[model samples]
Target: MHPAAQQAISTLLAEGKTPSVATVKAKLTEPLPMPVIIAALASYKNNPEAITHTAQQSQPAPAKPQSQLDRIEAKLDKLLALLEEKQ
Candidate 1:
């Protein structure tokens, strides 16, 4: 079972809600195969502890710096619009 699926199920359980395909799928950050989700649900039913494992902490992605080319492109676009307006 995918770790994300397990975490979703665990979260649902913690929230006092039963985990279903729709609910589990909705809780996932990324999409998983239907069969994989189904199998994970079944596995959870068989052993709830499997889904109760500690969730791993994920770090947020760093912000990307704006490139010089992007700034130049924006300036060119503005210049083009102004030129078009005067035409």
Candidate 2:
């Protein structure tokens, strides 16, 4: 099961709502394919602990690297300089 779907299932279980295609879809931040959701539901049914396990195993989104941000800032600075030169 996709981590997102697993997380959604865990959340739904915690919320005391049954996890179904529509219900899970509603709980998710982004829409997932029906097949993936269905598979997740099957996985959950086969092993209820998987949801809890997945939730615990899930990692938070990593922050964007500072170097990448700096590169973008440098590009924007160059663009501004070019625009000023034209003016």
Candidate 3:
């Protein structure tokens, strides 16, 4: 199913509204095929929590910051390069 369709279903559930093909289709920002909408709705009806879990898993993980030791090492490397150039 399309991500938008999944999101539409999730949104409808959150708003305490039942998700039918028409409702999900209407909620969608972009146009999708009737079959896709129907499939999504059926899947959602069968396993509501799966939809929410899938949506959460679909999100990209946050980037990790460089460690302080890594930063210090980089600075030391640069300083050594500068000294080598001077010599």
Which model scores highest in TM-score?
Answer: 2
Ranking of predictions according to lDDT: 3, 2, 1
- Model 1: residues with Cα > 4 Å off, grouped in runs: 53-87
Tens-digit per-residue lDDT, 5-70, candidate 2: 887788799899989888888777456889999998999999998778767777557665345468
Whole-model Cα lDDT of every candidate shown, in order: 0.79, 0.81, 0.84
Which residue segments of model 3 deviate by more than 4 Å? 59-87
Question: What is model 1's C-alpha RMSD?
Answer: 10.1
Give a tens-digit lDDT track for model 1, residues 40-61: 9999889876555544343225
- RMSD for each model, in Å, please? 10.1, 7.6, 12.8
Q: Model 2, residue 53: what's the lDDT?
A: 72
Candidate of highest lDDT: 3
Going through the candidates in the order shown, the clash numbers are 0, 0, 0
The lDDT, on a scale of 0 to 1, for candidate 3 is 0.84
Compared with the true structure, the alpha-carbon lDDT of candidate 1 equals 0.79
What's the TM-score of every candidate structure? 0.59, 0.63, 0.62
Model 3: per-residue Cα lDDT over 3-49, one tens digit each: 87987887788899999988998888567999999899888888988
